[model samples]
Target: MTATRVCALSELEQDSAIRVEVEGVAMAVVLDSAGEVHAIGDVCTHGDISLAEGFVDGDTLECWAHGSAFSLRTGQPLNLPAYEPVPVFAVTIDGDDVLIDPAVKKAV
Candidate 1:
C-alpha cells in the first residue's frame, strides 16, 4: 500500500481536523482529544458538500449540510440525513510526518 504524506503532526491540533486531497480524493484528517489520528472522506454521504467544511467535535464529524454526524474511527453515520458512511483512510504517524493510506475502505 502506498502512503501519501498529508502533513506534520505538529500541524494538527488536538480535537481539530484538516482537509487534504490525495490521488484526486478529498479527505479530512482529524485528530481527536486523545491524540489519535483519523482519515475520512471529505464529502458528506447525504450531500455533495465536503465534510471538512463541517464542525468536528470529539470523534464525530458533524456535517454542515444537514447536521449529520459520523464517527471518525469507524465511519459510521451517527445521526440522520446521512444514512451512508463516508470513506475512511488509514492514518500513520511517521516521526513528525502524517501519512495516509487512501486504499483503505471506509466503514459504515
Candidate 2:
C-alpha cells in the first residue's frame, strides 16, 4: 500500500471533511464527532462532485450536491440517490501528521 502524508492532525475540525489528493487519487479526510480522523474517497458515487466539498454531521458525511450521506467508519451510503458505495481509504495518525493508505477501498 502506498502511504502519503496529507496534512497535520490539528488542521481538521470535528465533524467536518476536507478534500485532498493522495498520489493521483482524490481523497477525503474526515473528522468525526469523536474527533477521529478518517480517510475516504472524495468522489460521490451518483455524481461527479467531491465528497469533501460536502458537510459532516456526527459520523455521517453528506454530499452537498445531492444529499447522499455516508458513514465514516463503514463507508456505507445512508441516504438516497447513491446506491453504490464510494471507496474509503485507511488513515493513520503518526504523531502530528496524517498518513493515509490509498489502496484500501470502502464505501464512504
Candidate 3:
C-alpha cells in the first residue's frame, strides 16, 4: 500500500500531537521539540485512552490516562501499566505534506 497524506507539515505545531486515521488505523502524528515528525499508534497499549491527547516531551509521548510514556520513534512503552510497545508507522514528509502508511511499521 502507498503512503496516505495525513496533513500538511505546517498544520502541526512543534512539540504537539495530532490524531489521524489511515486505512482505519488510528494514529498520533507528533512533531517533536526538535521538529521531527513521528507516527505512532494512537491508542495506549495499557488502556483505551488516546495517545494523541498525551503530553509530548522530547521524543516520548506520555499517555494521559496512565502516565505511560511511549517512545515516539520506536513506540516502546517507557513506564508501568503498559508493557507492550505500540505500533510505529512510517512517516514521510514531502514538501508541505505529511504522509503516513499504516501498513508499514517502522523498524525500531
Q: Best candidate per TM-score, number?
A: 3
Clashing pairs in 3: none
Per-candidate TM equals 0.92, 0.91, 0.98
lDDT of each: 0.87, 0.84, 0.95
Residues 1-108, model 3: lDDT tens digits:
899999999999998899999989999999999999999999999999999999999999999988999999899999899999999998999999999989999987
True-vs-predicted CA distance for residue 37, candidate 3, Å = 0.1
User: Residue-wise lDDT of candidate 2 within 1-108, one digit each (tens)?
Assistant: 567899999998888888898778988899888878888778888899899989988887899999999878877899899977777777878899999878866443
Q: What's the residue-level lDDT of 66 in candidate 2? A: 97
Task: Give the TM-score (vs. native) of candidate 1.
Answer: 0.92
Candidate 3 Cα outliers beyond 4 Å, as residue runs: none
Displacement of residue 7 (Cα, Å) in model 3 is 0.3
Best by lDDT: 3
lDDT of 3 at 26: 99
User: After TM-score superposition, what is the CA distance of residue 80 in candidate 1 from its true location, in Å?
Assistant: 0.7
So what's the TM-score on candidate 2? 0.91
